[model samples]
Target: MRQKTQRRWRILRRIDAESRALAETLGIHPVSACVLLNRNLTEPAALQHFLNPSLESLHDPYLMKDMDKAVARLRQAIDGQERVMIHGDYDVDGVAATAMMVRMLSALGVDVTHHIPHRVDEGYGVSAEGIRQAAANGVKLVVTVDCGISAYEEALLARELGLDLIITDHHQPPPAFESQIAYFGAAVAVLNPNRPDCGYPFKGLCGCGVAYKLATALVENLGHPGNALQRAYLDLTALATIADIVPLRDENRAIAQFGLERLSDTKKPGLKALMGVCGIAGKRLSSYHVGFVLGPRLNAAGRLDTAETALNLLLTRDDSEAGRLADALNQLNRERQEEESSTLQDAELMIESGADALGGDILLDSDKALVLASEDWHMGVVGIVASRLAERYVRPTILITMGEDEGKGSGRSIRAFDLKKGLDGCADYLVGYGGHAQAAGLTVTRGQLSQFRARFLQVADEQLGADDLIPVVDIDCELGPRDLTFELVNELRRFEPYGHENPGPVFAIRGAKLLDQCTVGANGKHLKLRVGFWEASYDALWWRKGDNFGRFSRHQLLDLCFSLDINEYQGIPSMQFVVKDVQPS
Candidate 1:
């Protein structure tokens, strides 16, 4: 774990006293006032927009680069009654996007088929074999969501085979690839927010979010703004946006907020049943629900078997089958969790024994470029395990699982390093590699392991600094006992659906007296404490903080940073602080 530091508090300066006056004048809570102050939501209009998140504020879908061409091509295909296939990645984001496209096109009476590439065999995006398969099935046009940005060779092959492709992806492009080669060997409308040529603002949309935009453009162009089928696909957009862990701000924030509303009455049987099984039914499902509950279940099918299971689950309208599939996915999730834990434990053990000896940015090599392989390691769970290892070790962690005659590697990197770029720098040793800066995958020959390790570490040593290896906590503002209130908590809702870049605000409170304390939850994993000044008691719960019991006590003065949350039990609403940290004074 990165060591914690106690520093002098710096209040966010952007918030003037007017926000506080607004809170006081409007009978809003001070906590909400602080939240507003922290996010620099000082302007009345901005505050109003944050408070009233509506679809009207959303940017035009056509603002996306190539959105016009993509919609035009799709309309042409629909008008021509041409066979079109929705090519999607195997992950949750890709699958959800695929489902969204399929639903919309089918509603429009377009002949549409959806195809998800197998993670193990086809890897990601548009594969050569997948294109051939689509052609064999009479698919003349293909729209790829969440992938195909890096499939230059596959796109070339598809063009030769007489297929038309539209690429919609959000991953950063390789320096060498300026534009995505569409299926017809020519660069068609490649809609990627990360492309330098694209001028549309808000570059952090998830693949499914991009797909939803495309669908919206298509529907709007078709002059059907009130199309029920068009709006129904927002739930998929919400699922993918949250699942992909993109920054939930601006357009993404609106999509997630709107999507959650629709998800409450979602038409997808598999999703409804999955939520039921996970016990999130009738509760306010946040981005956390998508990440922890829904995403993993959908991902399990792709990881353990094929993504088709998840795609079918989303597309299937049958209730009984949805129940059965939900059960199967739940079981798969449990099995996956077990595999992840065991693999993580084994990796930890390996590090404990020799990690220190071979330190300087970890390079755990065996016969493969990375030796995450164990008899117990499930291939589907390795990427997550690798990410976890990277988070803990502060290194570019590569988890390799032994495959027949070759080894597959999944890597996760820190902010200072780019995994894909680094892998691209050492492309001679790798057979194939593709991913974003923070996460990537590659295949390496056993003979190239040593050379790859040396090259990777050299790149890290040259680029990274000591501070880059350590995690930094950036607090939004400072607060006192009198500052936290129910009204304040309500105001904080302006920052709802927080993820990635626009994280929920973390506020620091110094010299707070701990009035009461206890451990609760299953396995006593959570810590609860009443903190306050005289006559003011604010309840706080630290999920997964029992491990830090040694540092906390009742009646002790402490400094803490936390975000306010509301807990509704039996229809009674109560406020709670989701504690981020607590340091004894």
Candidate 2:
């Protein structure tokens, strides 16, 4: 056993008094109050905002940059009875957005057909062939959701074909079109918060969030709040908001909190069946449910076969058919998980062989601009893997699945790096690229892969630093052993639905004793232990921490960082620490 070091408690100098005051005012423990203050919820208004997330508090949908123009164009199409095409990306955000728009238009009695581009054939966004197909099918107006903000070439083609395009996307803009592409207003109206001059109050919206705004603006303008379709689509917006992993803050929090409520009693046959199969029917759902269980199944369709399966499942109205589709999606999710593990192993090996030794600023490349091939690398899971790789490496990472002549790659980045801006720096080597600061996608020619790789590395070298690459854990307060109490734990519940931006609070606990410890789980992969603090002993489990058990010893005093969680096991509810890290005393 390793010896533990004595620990000292610390507090932020500026907020010490304020934290104490907040605890008194809110009737919560001092440590819980400190956690709230640490999250910048110091002001009364901030506390109110966090505690009461209501729809009336939501930001105006029209506050978005392209709202007026996008709404105007959609209204015109509806008024004229023009044939409209809802062209969407294949992921959950895209599918939900497409389904929302389609249902709304169908209710408006407009001729609308939804089209989700196949992952294998069409890749992402509006392709030339996709645009041509829409035109040939008499799609007079094309509204793109969750994608196409960066489709300069494709938008130009739509203009030439006399098709009106309204792009409601959340991806970052390409360099050439970074400054208001105007494909929408000039000929179409493009709605995206990330536009350099968009002037939208919040720029953190996901693609589906933007689509929801578009739908909201359209429905409101048409004076149809009571419309069945308008009401039904809110659940889609909720699913997308949760699936896209956007911060549950500001308007997004309002949407998701209420949206989950809508999902619990959803009237849509497809959603009802999907929820039933996932064993969440009639239960209050949270973002955790969407991210872990539902999102993967919806995404599995695109990863293993065609995203059309997901789109169909979302759009269908038959219980039996929805059940069949849901089962298939569940199976596909299992297949995706298996393939993801295999690819991740190879990626882990490649990174371990010194590629990621820098501990930051990772650059992954091969004969292709990004090597996406692993015999069974399901396309859907690659994005998730790429995101994981980026987070692990603490740098922008591009994971590619090789194509015949070129390759398709997805890029995820850390806060210090703006992935889209970096990709723009290497535009000469890219066939096409676009996405937000943290995540993006691109196509690169085989011949230019070397140049792209070099440029990417150079950009990182110029832009990043040693400190910028390391992970940061921001603590709200330091609590002594005596501070562990059930009341304190229950008081923290005021801040429910914690997620990105408004993360669950982390607290420091000092002078704790490890009463018992053991490596548990299948193959002894996890750490399980009993920790004694205050006058009580509590059970604690740390997933994937078996390898790190060297940091603690039996009956050793130590400092621990963790979040409090209420775990209900076998009808017993108890407070447990979701252990983050441990240090010697």
Candidate 3:
């Protein structure tokens, strides 16, 4: 189902002579310059870098707080021929990070094994049981990827078990201590850019990026000094970076651009097999391919079961094993989709059904944030459902699967609200919680469900105002029939592989007369309309908006916000407006 929430259009462009001057100086379209200015890239050098972020310009790995310590510890482990375990979470980011570490460490002659904690049994982060088991297995060094920032107790457990730990994580660290030490000084080193004391210039790195940084530093510390080795793993870094939904700014842009290039011709059988299964085998990859097409499949293993399948797909050299793992991940993703759809339906019914499903006589609209739960809901699918509800309702939403004594839930919040901070405010009611500002996972005892709900709503109320609850569709600029051209669309295409922090440009046009309209696609699931401003009539495709066919009529003046695209048919290419939002003018 699609979200029904109407969005407020926020036009970001204004008359700016600087953008015009920049366009003239840079020999590019003024619209592109305006978009770059919107991202605060004014200087020519900065604009150039933004347009083409290169791997050669990556920040020094040693700039991170404990990169040296982490590298030195890993070097010691290698010298001693000690067994090292790469601890990872079950998600794509963690699995990618783990895969990179295993490859890098194995190449350096280290006896490397990896552990991906079971979602149900071990939950998340550096597991205490995992640490003890690693010790029992004669693993002398434990290195965590994509997790362990919040593993204070687990860090202590590793220390008690006489194991040296090097933590590489990207999650927001807890409130600072006096020393600014990483992970409560339980391990040898923690390499996280988010550590308050870490002076790493780019803090937008996802967990896999951090792991790549550590790998770079470690390899540079040893005989290999250049980035040839680092470039080899860009495929994994890019995959995890896009999958993790981190900002695509600074080095991340370079990592993604270069990594996507490498992924197109990846040497790894596992990635190739995964891509083949995703039906993107020979295509030049982009963030969309990774984020939407491949990411969910890789994430499915972690969500439905363990991340072993996904991790194996990244690590396996055998084409047969890679194909098997890819197929397994694809099957798991289908199951995950079914679970997510069912849970979303259940939650939507609960929201619309009113007082009986939701709490009290108050309707859902009365609360600033939703906290919906069901015993029948699968824990793995709640996060996906929460994201859907948050998008649909235009507010923060938490979906919990009730257990006998406790409930495990996930919360996805609007950009205006910080979910992690809100969970911090309700820490007293939660057993544990950790994640970024927009998404978080939590465990709450069954007894405190109502209290937690009330507290979370209070937090949302305190942070979000009436305006914040309404979603905003940012319009890069306005365009008329004359302004929409093949040239403009071609220039906008420069910002390919757009994602977080760097979204594709959305343009709006006002008072376009709807000449004709019809439904398209299976079950009439899409809208195909012809709208004109003056002498120019353009076709518009509103994906999944066929249900809105009744909203407007022929000859009606309508306002449309859309992104430009060139639709190619056979041997010819024609301009197509991919509509995002539409309303009667």
- Candidate with top TM-score is 3
Residue pairs that clash (backbone atoms under 3 angstroms), model 3: none
332-384: candidate 3 lDDT, tens digit per residue:
99999989888888788778876324262325667888888778887888998
The lDDT, on a scale of 0 to 1, for candidate 1 is 0.77
In candidate 2, stretches whose alpha carbon ends up further than 4 angstroms from where it belongs are 1-15, 178-186, 226-231, 354-379, 518-525, 546-551
TM-score of 1: 0.88
Tens-digit lDDT track for model 2 on 418-480? 887888788888887777678887887766766777788778777887666665556676776
Each model's Cα RMSD: 3.9, 4.4, 2.1
The predicted structure with the larger lDDT, 1 or 3, is 3
Model 2 clash tally, residue pairs: 13
| TM-scores, one per candidate | 0.88, 0.88, 0.95
> Candidate 1: which stretches are off by over 4 Å?
1-49, 179-184, 226-230, 355-376, 418-424, 514-522, 530-532, 536-539, 550-554
Q: Considering summed lDDT, which 10 consecutive residues are worst modelled in model 3? A: 354-363
Rate residue 234 of model 3 by lDDT. Answer: 90
- Lowest lDDT 10-mer window, candidate 1? 360-369
> How many clashes show up in model 1?
4
lDDT of 1 by residue, 224-281 (tens): 8734543688788888988888877677878889898788778789889989999998
